[model samples]
Target: MKKLLSIKNIIISIAALLLVWEILFLCSSYSKALFPSPLMAFYALIEMIRSGTLLSNIGTSMYRFAAGYFSAVAAAVILGLILGRLPKVFQYINPVVQLLRPISPTAWMPFVVLLFGIGDIPAIVIIFIAAFFPVLLSTVSAVGNIDPIYLKVAKNFEISGSAATWKVIFPAVFPQIANGIHLALGTAWIFLVAGEMVGAQSGLGYQIIDARNNIRADILLATIFVIGVIGILLDSLLKSAEKRILKLWGLK
Candidate 1:
């Protein structure tokens, strides 16, 4: 029942947005080519799907996204686990992290492209940079904020070192870490498009640029819609994964 309500709400919200969009297009002085109606964009979406261009670009973006996102998260979580256990070490490192974290991932695109050239690497690197800091900081903070009684309980059970960190500490801090992961998903996904726009030959971002170059407002709008839909899907998948993990660990 809850799921059905959620789906119904989503449909109603989307319909309302489309209605507003069509109204704006109707009221605007701009040409249809310059400001496409929702129906025009839907037609353009169908055209892209028929051409296979949309699917190919989506695959490329997903490949880069998966490569960069998973690797960064894994590295960040591992390092965070270690750093969480060492407050003094983190104190020394936190300043450097703070210094670097504020910089936009896209700001590095020029340098990244210079080194990696116009290919997957530059976009992947951008995504890595975008995702890394959030998870690392969150994990470290979560570990630091863990209740002392949990550690005591683990110690009482004769658990120590790797066992304690993985079995006790990780589970205890995961709720907090999950927040960072969720945050990173949106950040990294946004940068993935931006990075692709600057560095890659093909992807949803590039599709936007391509459409603009050809003066295809319908296609551009369609691609924008696709990017938004994909972001929502990715968020849903991550949430589902988080739920399963929490359930497995008896933490949900």
Candidate 2:
């Protein structure tokens, strides 16, 4: 009953917001093309849905996102584990990482476009770049900051090499690494959209561009709203995955 009430309240709040928006739209002197009402945006969303353009763009964007994000996670975690285990290697690489870390992934758009041309390649590369450092740094920190007593325990048990790294260290640092993944996913999504907007011919980002070019403010606004909804869904999915992992590790 309480949960139902909570959901009801949320719906009411959203409805109120839309009502206010409609009222403002009616009162405002601005052109509907420039500032579309919620109803107009909804109709636009329906049109896109009916035509299958929205689903196609969403699928394309998700494909690029999943490919790049998973690749980044794999590469970053592997490299982070190696570096975390060997301080000397990390020390040598730290300077270069620090230098590159501050640069925005979007700033690489021109270079990637020039090198890879306008397509999925540049978008995926941008997502990878955006996601890589966060996961790497988080993993490295998590692994490096593990307690000395854990290592002592592993040594006493004679769990050496790959066994020690996998069984002992990986489990200990996984929670922190999961947190990094969450953060990286959000950053990757943002970069993916921006990359798609600039380079890709077909995506949610391209839809936004197409809307703007065609002077369809309703479509643009609807796409932006859909982006937010998709982002929330992606975050929820990652959190669910993290929870499952933590549960398996008995850390939850």
Work out the TM-score per prediction.
0.95, 0.94
- Those runs of model 2 whose alpha carbons end farther than 4 Å from true positions after fitting are none
Off-target runs (Cα >4 Å) in candidate 1 are: none
Clashing pairs counted in every model: 0, 0
Q: Lowest summed lDDT over 10 consecutive residues: which window, candidate 2?
A: 164-173
* Backbone clash pairs in model 1 (N, Cα, C under 3 Å; residues 3+ apart or in different chains), count: 0
Error of 1 at 238 (Å): 1.1
Tens-place lDDT digits, model 2, residues 1-252: 998998899899889988998998999999999889999999999999999999999999999999999999999998998899998889999899999899999999999999999999999999999999999999998889998888999999999888988889988898889989999999999998999999899999999999999999999999998998899899989889889999998877
lDDT tens string, model 1, 1-252? 999999999999999999999999999999999999999999999999999999999999999999999999999999999999999999999999999999999999999999989989999999999999999999999999999999999999999999999999998899889999999999999999999999999998889989999999999999999999999999999999999988977877
lDDT by candidate, in order shown: 0.96, 0.94
Q: What lDDT is reached at residue 37 by model 2?
A: 99
Candidate 2 root-mean-square deviation in Å: 1.7
